[model samples]
Target: MQESSEVAGSIVSEDCLDEVIQEQIKTLKNAQTAALSAVTKRRNEIFRLMDNCDNLHLVKSEVIILCKLRDKYDESFQQYEKHLTDSSERNTVNKRHSENTASIDRFITEMNNWVKESELQLTADLDRKSLCSSSTTRTKSSRTSVRSARLKEKARLAELMAQHAMREKTKVMEEQELRLKQEREEQEFRLRKKKEQLELETKIAMSQARERVYAEADNISDIVPKDTPSPLNPNVDPFQPQPSDITVDTPQLKANVPCSSSHCRFPEPNLDMQLQSQQEMFLKTQQHMTAAMLLPSIEVPKFKGDPIEFATFMMAFDARIAPNASGDADKLYYLDQQLEGEAKDLIGGCLYMSSSEGYTSARSLLSQEYGDPYKVSMAYIKKLISWSALKHEDPHGLYTFALFLIKCRHAMTNLSHMEVLNHLPNLQAVVKKLPTYLQNKWCSLAGHLREEKGGVDFADLVEFVYRKAKAANDPTFSKFALQNNYSKP
Candidate 1:
């Protein structure tokens, strides 16, 4: 019974030992699988981070994460390796110890080699990326330097060209000055000669008048009858009256006397007065001629197939007139009188007449009839705006439209905000195509309008818009605004 029990106990121990070896193998295999999964996961994360290496900031952050993962992987792998070695030494008494130890050693060696290769690959990739980044930065710097050099050369060339142009302009100006001086000197010489001639003629006329006066006195003395007695010499003999006693009525004698010579003219005093008046008139005429000469001769630009061509020209001409005079009703009336025929009819009917209450009736008639002036004006303005916006050309049209707006603003005191708003889009479109300064000015005006807490006053807004348009640097617009006193009282 004892022997049988011993034998049974030995078999139970053998079974328990086999079970322990199997459990150890299973645990080792699980650890190895876990470690492999962790390595794979870390490797994938590193690869993802490497793929995005173009972003330095992201790559830097990923590097830190990869380092931590690598550390964790190493720790876990070392722990697994230590556990496998210990399990192999403890199971040395078991027949499967050599196989299990060899397998664990192979796995650990392979994992270690893989870790080293992966780390070396990561380092090589980082070095290559750094080199590439340095090369790209150098290339960019070189390109920028080349572009800057080109720009500088271009600026230098432009400056040289400008200087050359300025030199040419100065030369032309000097030549013009010399020519003007020569012309002025010639005119002065001619005027001086004319003045000397006039003086000589005056002297000759005075001598001739003296001789004629003496001759007339002698004739009167000879013609007087001997029988006629002088009132002052009643006591003396009628035919022997003394020269001192002879009292002649000079005024009556001069009036009744008729000169037989055709060359006889007005008295010397009257002639002198007439000559003085003529000299004054000539001086005035000379002064006017000089002023006209001094003024710059501007060639009026030609317009073809334009309905408002003459009107535009006249408006421009009016603008060139002095602002103070241009705004005067008398001056405008004078200008109207100067016009003749079709020109008179066109400008007078279109602008001058439309400036007052008469235009309202005309507009009303036109509106009631077929051709509305307001509609025509609006259509023209719309066309100008479209042209300006699309081509970024034809500043004249834009300038004309602005001028029209200013005129309308002044003429129509009842111009409403709604009316301005209706034309606001067109105005803005034209403004966009304007020069930078004008665009800025319009923007500033718009901003100011927007900032006003209270609603914009119609009259004030109209005035502001007119003033803004008048402020443009365009000479035509400037002249128009000044002539009409668009912003002034």
Candidate 2:
């Protein structure tokens, strides 16, 4: 009982534990109490037999009642400590927890102690039964001795009565012996009848108690399994599923290369022949690798006169082909190859100029016309203003809108054009472009941010919108879970 109290104490304070477990402990602590605990106590259970030392009904009855209480206690405790952790009380040491759990631990400990003490008392029971058997054995033995002596005396009388009548006297003695045997059988039958009557009464009492248990609660049968599990090992893991074979279907590559049938190899080659073959093979493979490099891994973006596209196009051109080109002439040629429509024609005159001056002239013309930070930044604002109002605040549309805002934010980052994006009027216009529901969410978010930082920025709204958009996306989306999405305050 103390150990269970200690386990419960580790979580809950003494006061809360008292409120929850004190009531139950009160019932069990006293032998006079008529609760479940007192009913299944050691003295009245399997430890001792009935008064006659014949009926085992008390043992079976105690076992059944204990099992019922065990189930009820298990359910109550499971609900109590299901997800309750002691760590939650780290900041508040006085906080009470696991109120139901305290009661469960108390009941389990009480039952386990009952079982233990009963086993000890069983030793005394064994001695008592042995004594009962010895007494019955001695009485039966004395009766047998007396009957044997009487038979001996009768045989002596018969011998004195008849030498010629010996056969008739022997028959008469046999009849007397048979009569005595019948009388002994009648006595044993009467004892058996008495025991049977006692057994029937015990069975009736047990049946009435069982019916009362059923009448008290029908769900009791459902809650308690036939072969009840031990409470100590409640956390035992169920059988784990074994890993199964995984099969993947993929497109198989087929041969497209022309097969060679030269049949040109020699088992032993002259030095000149081997040297020539090696040189030819190495040069041919090197040429093939160089040809492979000419095919671009990333498809080049075709830029028109749109300033919005200017920053990304220039960044891509600069990263991939521009730095590798030793001469400006090569850079200009690659740049022209990546332009189209208004952008290509805008640099047409410079393309015809001499290589030395042509590249510089074309490059400056393109940057001046399409790569101005102010122009690029204005284009982003224009995009936001021109964005069509959403028909509904659906996850896909919200996600798409969030992506556009994110792109604008990323583009303006290096350009230092955040002042335009952070303008209150511009932010309001962006919020206005949202569907009714999201507009409200954005307002709430903006209010929260304004309280914290005095004002909300484009980055803040983008982050806020992106989070909700991602969270509202379907569970089939592999990237995010709702808990993970909204984890931060």
Candidate 3:
């Protein structure tokens, strides 16, 4: 598809260039005709002028002017000729380009036809294979029954484990909730006690001030009772014209009042500072919770601790169908397998996230997804890791397992280098340890990814991979691979 598209584009470009050259040729011809007409008119005028003059001096002067006019016309014609030559060269090049385009188009069309025929043949072969397999199975019904029984047993075990994990998660959540409630109660109690202490201190200070005032009054009575009026009878005798009845009043102290927590006004918090703190806390809490939840994930069973199960499956499936027709059967089978993985990843990733709330959460994500969710989590992680830089930390075997996802061509198209590079610290460590051939293959893949759309639209990390691969001269990327044009966007 890509090669054909490029061939088509080249054809169009050549056509456009030819049209431009044709226009230039037309312009040059017009200019040449104008210059020739001017030259002819100038010669006629000079000749007539010479005839009208009988003097040799006049004739010589006319001839001299005519020579100048002829020279001017010659220069103009020479320039026009040069332009015409340039136009001709352009036309030649355009013609060559058109011929090359026609050849490419022919090749592309033929290749496309071959591909279509190959696909049809492959489909027919697959159908034949299915019939054969079915007939063979009919002959071995006992074996088929045994295999089915084993698969059912495996499924039952898987379901049992999943249920156990869910139960454990529920218990863990209950415990967490209880702890949270206890902490909340403790915090509330502390706040209540602190408020009470503040109110008590206020009351004690107010009582002491009242006592001091009472003591001062008692001392005044003890020292000057004779000069002081009676406590009550002095003010009662309003008819008495006593000078003591006009006694001056002393300054009275105001008592301290306790403030109510319910009505006490608090200064508003600084919006910027408060918001910053909230955001920081929220981020920290979110990360902590996510990490904690993920920690209990169930371990995915491995194929004898092998990390290349998916890769092996795809390659094997490809090989199985490769002989059918131009590898179309293999491509389709692998594509279907790839789609299954993606779908599993979606279902399993979400389930793992849910199960991660407890002991089930702390286990390996890959294991849980494979068993309980029976899905792939890489796709989910890919989206997350792309959006945030934090997904690269401690990318273990499960992280590498996620790479199986790149087989989904469309999914790969949506990713970017920044998202991939963010995981570079981990990827680099893995790449160095990989066999040279595998490393080369990875780099070649990376280069194709980069060049696919005139530079990788997804991730930039692969450019580094491209450089390394180029330096290593990986077999996966030959001269042909580099020169092979891709489909137009």
Q: Of the candidates shown, which would achieve the greatest TM-score relative to the real structure? A: 2
lDDT of 1 at 308: 30
Return the clash pairs for model 2, or none: none
Model 2 misplaced stretches (Cα beyond 4 Å):
1-296, 323-327, 477-489
Write the residue-wise lDDT of candidate 3 on 151-237 in tens digits: 999999999999999999999999999999999788667656755655565456555555665566566445432433334576565
The reply for model 3, stretches above 4 Å from the true place, is: 1-139, 223-225, 228-489
**TM, every model:** 0.26, 0.37, 0.20
- lDDT (CA) per prediction: 0.55, 0.68, 0.50
Model 3: lDDT of residue 297: 33
For residues 333-434, could you state the per-residue lDDT of candidate 2 as single tens digits?
A: 888889999899988898788886988888898898888787777778888889988756366777899899898888766777746888888888888877
Q: What's the ranking of the predictions by TM-score, best on top?
A: 2, 1, 3
Better of 1 and 3 by TM-score: 1
Q: Which ten residues in a row have the lowest lDDT in candidate 3?
A: 389-398
